[model samples]
Target: MPTKELSPTELHLWNIVENNPEKIAKMSIVKLSQYAHVSTATIVRTMQKMGYGGYTSYRESLKIRNNSNSTFNVLNEADDKIRSVITKNEIEMNNTLHNLSYSTIEDSISMTKQAKIVYIFARGLSESIAEEIMVKLQLTGKYCEFHSDPNIIRTIASKIKKDALAIFITLNGETDELVAAAQKLSKNDIPVLTFTTNKAGKILAFSTLSFIGYKSKTNYFPEYEVRSRLPLQIMTRIFCDAYSVRANFYKSN
Candidate 1:
């Protein structure tokens, strides 16, 4: 938090960005200079000399640098503080992973036993994971499928029987189109499950269950962005395993 020991250019840029990242996040070098003590040429030259393509790339780099810095600070604050202070984030994330794995398994088992149709809805990166979930759950011989596009999802939702279940993945839990499809399914007496960062969002109300996780705090490190793909992937594995075990048990019974 202290500005001490920062390079002169770093200090200037920090001062400009620290007060208003919203505006700074959208500024050109000329605008940035008007907001800071640094000049336009100084901004461009320093940025290029620092190996940036231009001021914009350099400004984007600052956001990564700041997130990394926050992660560092998170690691530095007393170990006890870090341990006990779940920061409203860690709590939500861990809870989400736990609840999803358990409930999804239960749901999968019940669906399998009853031969209920399954569908998954996820866009963006998690769409791939949803595909995998569908495939793995498909091994139980339940008719499971998913589509990443809202148009396709809506079509499927319309045809899903009243006994079917769907799991919709929205990392932020605020996708209007995705939640709309989920809502449509719910209105027809179908069950919906949601995976997101905010269970309290409208998706939760639309779904039979909602899982919330914050990927923000866990995705960066000093000097680089350490991808959170592993943790997310591992959780996905747990979910599949739980589902598989339950599904197999039902088959044997």
Candidate 2:
């Protein structure tokens, strides 16, 4: 969680939880609130703010965490480039699975399914990814529009209906044009969905729902180039596939 996302009271409560996560699983909300010197309402509000439905859901999650017993081991060195690629992708996929917020993904899928129109905005290499998303959704009989041009994006975003959905794909989430377009959508009361690197950025602040891919390190040389986009690509595929399955189930029923 980003510091910018937390209120002063929430931050205080979060600090306590961070320092005493194991104890939190055993403590009731009332006890936790009392210990933090805040009201139960504060605790409930904090849970909602952090994307949980309520105290019970959040508490149950904490309890589940306390019961988890997982271990990790480093991958062995590969004998060839092909083997190395597979090994690295496996590691990155695990990282993404560990870091992903399924609640957020579900929320995004719900919004997309309900939206009157879906607009996908991206630039450069991400524009191709956006087009792929558009095609995937369209193939499933979902209406989608793709926009990579800044001027066109701003124009459409300003005019889109509140019931429409805006999906922005940016690796860093700091592109000036995309951020400006997101702001426009925000002002119009349209929901903005974003896929970006795990680093905290302004775009996430503008998003109604957000998904984070594993962060990639900076490339320094040809041999060390961070060329793989498996994390984001995997997230995109999962979302599209999930939505398609849901759509089919609804139609079948």
Candidate 3:
């Protein structure tokens, strides 16, 4: 576990868990709160401060690690690392699915189907994900454009038609310029959608509809990835499928 300065309540909970890891796997949030002598809200806030989205995610990760054959071997062997990543990604996907709002996904698919054209905005590694969306959407016969350059994105935002839809992909939703441009499109009455981290952030606030995806631990060295974005990739694929289903369903009607 990563070490950081902890508050008294957090420390108490940590000590109990550290001494009896097995007990937590079967414990609910309410049970854990009672065992720690803390309120459920405090437990939730403590988890968030420790980098988890919520209690469920925190507990799931702990359970996954506990089940692993050898935690220390995770970094010692390539095979172990691969296994570890696969397990963690599976957990993340389940967490994302459990938390997803079906209505929001339906709204996003409906918006895409109704749009005359689609604009995709992403940068760096996320640009590939955006490109995939463009390709899949275009295959459905919807006109699409992808933008990575800030100037071009802003230019398109200013001139986008009201019937068009904009989809932005940002892992952290901390890209100030992209958020600004998306907000502009919202102001123009052009529906804006986004794919972002599970935790709430700026871009999500203005999106006409948004899909939350799994967020893995941050990689300090860009060249060597310690966590995989497979969960997010699966989410994009699911979104494409949903778009196709909605389009065909309406067409048959």
lDDT of each: 0.59, 0.72, 0.69
* Candidate 1 residue pairs in clash (backbone atoms < 3 Å): none
Instruction: In angstroms, give how far residue 167 of model 2 lies from its true place.
Output: 0.5
Best by TM-score: 2
Q: Where in model 2 is the C-alpha error above 4 Å?
A: 1-86, 218-227, 249-253
Q: Rank the candidates by lDDT, best first.
A: 2, 3, 1
The Cα RMSD in angstroms, rounded to one decimal, for candidate 3 relative to the true structure is 14.0
* Predicted candidate 2 versus true structure: per-residue lDDT over 4-33, tens digit per residue: 687898889878876887788677654675
- CA-only RMSD, every prediction: 20.8, 8.9, 14.0
- Report clash pairs, candidate 3: none
Q: Of the pair 2 and 3, which is ahead by TM-score?
A: 2
Q: What does the lDDT read for residue 98 in candidate 3?
A: 57
Rank all candidate structures by their TM-score, best first, as comma-separated numbers: 2, 3, 1
* TM-score of each candidate structure, all chains considered together: 0.53, 0.65, 0.61
Predicted candidate 1 versus true structure: per-residue lDDT over 37-120, tens digit per residue: 654434444443455534655556567766733211111222222433354345434544544433233433443344367788
